[model samples]
Target: MAEVRPAFDEAARTHPPLREASSARQDAHPRQIRDDDLAYGLERVLDGLAARLEA
Candidate 1:
């Protein structure tokens, strides 16, 4: 919306640095995603489909 951009910009400028918002602790494990996680994810397609779909 035309009214949203300036409001977002104002809040963004006032927001804290990103690191302060997230992890400050040591991790025992690293994050990961399997290969099939996206090859067949929230939305998938048929090679011969006539239309697209959304979740």
Candidate 2:
């Protein structure tokens, strides 16, 4: 859970729609950051799980 929450917070912070809704309500931004976060977070989570399995 600790590992996951940072990932989720990072994704939430970078999500284009949420950014727009909160501050830049008149603009649209790319979702690349969020996508990258998703990939990175998934990789980290899977790696952690795999390490636990190996232990």
Candidate 3:
């Protein structure tokens, strides 16, 4: 129960911070995200995830 409590509390605290960060980003100018940039970002994210999973 003690171990679980910390995990739950951490998640609760983290959620608000993430939401705030996202809100801040949303408040900024909406730039045109090019398809090439989207593809590059997705590839980088997937590659990082794959490397972590393989480790």
Task: State every prediction's TM-score relative to the real structure.
Answer: 0.24, 0.46, 0.40
- The residue ranges of model 3 lying beyond 4 angstroms of the native Cα positions read 1-33
lDDT of 1: 0.41
Better of 2 and 3 by lDDT: 2
Candidates sorted on TM-score, descending = 2, 3, 1
Per-model C-alpha RMSD: 12.7, 12.4, 12.3
Model 1 residue 24 lDDT? 28
- What ranges in model 1 sit over 4 Å off? 16-55
lDDT of 2: 0.65
* CA lDDT of every candidate: 0.41, 0.65, 0.64
Task: Kindly report which residue pairs in candidate 2 clash with one another.
Answer: none
lDDT tens digits, residue span 1-55, model 2: 4455456557768687764554432222347546766899999999999999999
lDDT of 3 by residue, 1-55 (tens): 4455456556657598765654454434435334545888999999999999999
Runs with alpha carbons beyond 4 Å of true place in candidate 2? 1-29
Residue pairs in candidate 3 whose N, alpha carbon or C atoms collide under 3 angstroms: none
Instruction: Give the alpha carbon lDDT tens digit for every residue of 1-55 in model 1.
Output: 3465456456656565633332221121223233435555534555325254432
Q: What RMSD value applies to candidate 2?
A: 12.4
